[model samples]
Target: MERPRYESPVERAIREAQERGEFDNLPGAGKPLDLGDTSDPMWWVRRLAEREQLDFTGALPPAVALRKEAATFPESLTALRTEESVRAVLEDYNLRVRRDRLRPPDPRMPQLLAPTVDVENLLARWRELRAAAGPPLAEPSAPEPRRRRRWFRRR
Candidate 1:
C-alpha cells in the first residue's frame, strides 16, 4: 500500500506545532496517560468536567441537585459550623426532594436522581467528620494593643 500523497491539515498543524515546541512541557508532559485502551462513553465529558473543576451534577435537573447534596452530605458537613447547621441543610434537602417527588411522573425528572436519604445516618456522618477534623482552633482571647498611635488622633 502506498502512503497518502498529502498529510491532513490537522497533521500538518501538529507537526508545525511540535517543531516550535508548542506541545512541550504540557500539564502531563512526562507522565503516562491515566487512561487504558478500553473506552468509556462519557470519557470526554468526565475529562472536561475534571479539567474545569466543575460539578457535573450542576447541569442536571433539580431532582439531581437534591440527591447529590444528600449523597455528599459528609463532605458538606466540614464546612458547616455546627450540628444544627448540618441538620438544617439536610432538612432543607430532604424537603426539596420530597417536594420534587410529589410531582406526577413527568419527562422533567432526572433518571438517576432518586434520593432515599436517612437523616439519622447523615447526622451520624456529620458527627464523625467533626470528630475526625478535631476541635476548632481557639480564637484570640483579646484584641492586641494598638501597634502605633493613629495619625488622626487629637493631640
Candidate 2:
C-alpha cells in the first residue's frame, strides 16, 4: 500500500488525470470515505440500510426479530385480533426461541438473540392492549318476552 517513488502506470494515469483537473472540485473533496465496518462481510448491505434509514431488524433471523418484537409486545399486540391470536403468536415465537436455543451457536455470528417470554405477562399486556383498543363487538340484544292480555289492553 506504499506510494511508488517511480511512477507506475496506474500512478501515471492518476497524475495525468490530476493534471487535467479530473479530481478537482469533486463531491466530498478532501473528506474521508465511509468505508464502514470493512471487516464485516455484509458491510455494504449494512451501509445501504444505514444510508436509507430502514428498519433492518425484520431482515434478521426469526429469533432476533422475535426478540425485537417482544421488546414492544404491547404495541405489537394491538395488531392482533383476539386473545387467542395473541397466544398463538406467542406460542410460535416461543417455539422459534426454543429452536434457536437448541441449535449450536455459530462461531462467526453472535449468540441467539431470542429471549424467553412469560405467557402470563404477555397475556396481561395483550389484555391491556385489547382494553385500550375500546370495547369488543357485542352480540344483539335478546328479544323481549311477549306479554299476555293486560287490563289496559283488549282481551
Candidate 3:
C-alpha cells in the first residue's frame, strides 16, 4: 500500500477551510512580510537588530537603547544643526587666532607702538615728569601789540 500524505491536524483544517472559500478574499489578500503594518515589538526589534548588526536574542545594549531614545527624543533638528554650526565656527575662529599669533607682524611699520617691557616704570616716569613740568611760560607778548595799521594808511 502506498503511504498517504501526512498533514498535521491544524494544517489539514486550514487547507480544508481554504478549499471551502472560508478564508478567500481576505482584507489583506496577499502581501509580503516586510511590507505589512507591523505593530509587534518583535518585528521592530528584529529590524533594529538587522540594521545595527546586533543580536536580537539578547537584551538591548545600553548604547542601542540610548540611540533609540535619541532618535525619537523631542528636539528640533534645526536647533541641533544650528548648535553644531556655531560650535564649528567658534573652533575655526580659535584656530585662526592661533595661526595669526604664530605669524610675524608687519616689518614695514617699525615705528608702530609695540608692547613695552617696562610698562609700569615708563608710565610712572612719564606721569612724574608731566606733573613736575611748569606751565609753558607763554612767550611774553610784545610790550605793545603790533597794530595792523601803520603810520601811513593805505590810500
Prediction 3 TM-score vs. true? 0.21
* lDDT of candidates 1 onward, in order: 0.75, 0.81, 0.48
lDDT of 2 by residue, 11-80 (tens): 7998789889998999999999989779999999889888999887766876777777778876777777
Error of 1 at 137 (Å): 3.2
Residue 126 shift from truth in candidate 3, angstroms:
56
Candidate 3: pairs in clash? none
Q: Considering summed lDDT, which 10 consecutive residues are worst modelled in model 2?
A: 56-65
Report the number of clashing residue pairs per model.
0, 0, 0
* TM-score, one value per model: 0.51, 0.53, 0.21
Would you list the clashing residue pairs of candidate 1?
A: none
lDDT of 3: 0.48
Q: Give me the overall lDDT of model 2.
A: 0.81
In candidate 1, clashing pairs total 0
